[model samples]
Target: MTLTLTDETPPKGFERLVRAEDPASGLRALICIHSTALGPAAGGCRMWNYARWDDARHDVQRLAEGMTYKNAMADLGLGGGKSVILGDAKRDKTPELFRAFGRAINALNGSYYTAEDVGTSPADIAQAATETPYAVGLEGGQYGSGDPSPFTAEGVFQCLRVGAKHVFGSEDLTGRQVLVQGLGHVGMSLAEKLHAAGAALIVTDIDQAALDRAARGLGATVIAPDQVFATQMDIFAPCALGAVLNDTTGPQLTAKLICGAANNQLAHPGIAGALHARGIRYLPDYVVNAGGIISVAGEIHKAGPGYRRDRLAGIAGRVDAMLTRAEQEDRNTTEIAADMVKEILASANRNVA
Candidate 1:
């Protein structure tokens, strides 16, 4: 199906370019949202063969907005934005396609920067970098670029430790059973941490290679993705896609804690309350997964390695503080975390103007 782009999306406080032809690569393009509230907008460029244009639009808008909040929460001086290419990643990838993407990004005049996301890789970002110097997360030990997935995993692992302390009143995962849904880079890293802490690990992924790796490397029990939602584990870690929590699956979860690297995990606004009703503690996705953004933000602003490390370590500590506040105030962790993020963003806005 040919997906057409509409020019009428809330004005977005920026520009939206939808192109079909390119001198570099011939592919459908949608450069969504450009915001200058903080500084230059930086976000991942996700490539996927969407079932519809609307799906692509939703992904770009939601992800761009998530990036905005993610950066704001991390105290990064970057606005949020995202780009999406409609085509099969495996079948339609080509130099021409990426080159065209580079050109599109180049036209943005540095208003938006691109990075790697699901279906997009560092190699792809490198290809796009060939067209524009604004692209980030390039491989080859580039000076200002590094893959953010591992950092994302590190943050999630730290948040899990915090969750354990708040709910179980201990940070040790020795006897805890964690069901990690999605054995990708982030998920596998988180599982390794859990294993290192002597926790029992159960992992699931659609890719057999990932499953086999988890089983071999971490001694994780591989299960089907669907089983993760209903697994009788202490923690349900979702390191996969977004919107996994909803009416259907929220009430069915048997895990005592829900924490992972996935962004925008809640299907809707009320899902947090649903988890609360079931006595399930949910670590807010945006707050917990801000590690990658923090790392990248440091690099972009030339904050140095020590600053980045301090920032990453500070995530675990902040998670601990948030959890403690939640328990002390008899409030849900998600609510308290969101309030913290809101205050941070508000402070940032004040600083900016």
Candidate 2:
């Protein structure tokens, strides 16, 4: 296993970036620490089959920075960092790779902590934890937070409820048309929640089994992935990858309210404005999808029992407050949420100075 720290100039607000490789295990990964303002940098390690090394680096940087704002806005009192392992998750997962990545994390001391993100699981985290104690989201431990997807789904569901109340004048989701684009673990969980709330579900995903499962179990109407943007629906929950609401898709969306568990949903800041221009209540992804991080943070802080539950429930209240603030200021929810995070980060920096 070989670990390398980058000599390239770190991005603005980034503290460090490092790479790790192991030919024997076919491990190739990069980790970025975006901040240590509130506390130790904490985020998830995502595995992907990126087209290039630069693509992975760019993803890690954006994800790490997003985590900084996410943790801040969620009031988790933790800093932000993220890591990415470039490979096909299904084909390349190995205990050896995660262990090697664990060593890379150990090199950072406790300045950063990692949990499971896209293409990763508690099993992977457990493998990494064997090499270092810096990893969270493990199973069978005192502070273990396990899989964060369900927690994440719960947060999104609650926020979606409040958003529905704001837009539809009622929290009731009964008979509401909802499109769930992506049926991953988190997406499926959110779909189930919405279905239980009596929302008519339209689902799409790359996995046929996932689509079929939702069709059979949740009675969700499966739509082709290409048809997602054009679908007319009351709510569009993008639980898939980031940047789905870019320049093109923003105009195609027919949903009045948007909420989901995906991180960094907006491709750019201006997309938020575009959604607002269309009168869409685009709830900030960081604020509504913070349950997973809040759960992992419980493990990082070694919290007592019930900490995760209480913290997860608080996300709904934050969404409520953010919506009200946005209305009062005549600004988009993304802007309002970003300002809230900036204020917290600035206060932490002031105290540090």
Q: lDDT for each of the candidates? A: 0.78, 0.89
What lDDT score goes with residue 265 in model 1? 89
- Give me the overall lDDT of model 2: 0.89
lDDT of 1 at 348: 65
Tens-digit per-residue lDDT, 1-353, candidate 1 = 12233445544445554443453355676776655577778788888999987888777877877777667556567888888888888888887677777777877788888777767777887888897987777655435648677788888888788889878989899979999888777888888888999999999889999989889999998888877666789998998888999889888888989999887788988898778777788988887787777766765676777766777777777778777787788777778877776677577668877
- Give per-model TM-scores: 0.85, 0.90
Candidate 1 lDDT:
0.78
Question: Where in model 2 is the C-alpha error above 4 Å?
Answer: 1-8, 21-27, 49-53, 86-93
lDDT of 2 by residue, 103-215 (tens): 88888889999988889988898899888999998886688887778988988999999999999999999999999988998999999999999999999999999999999
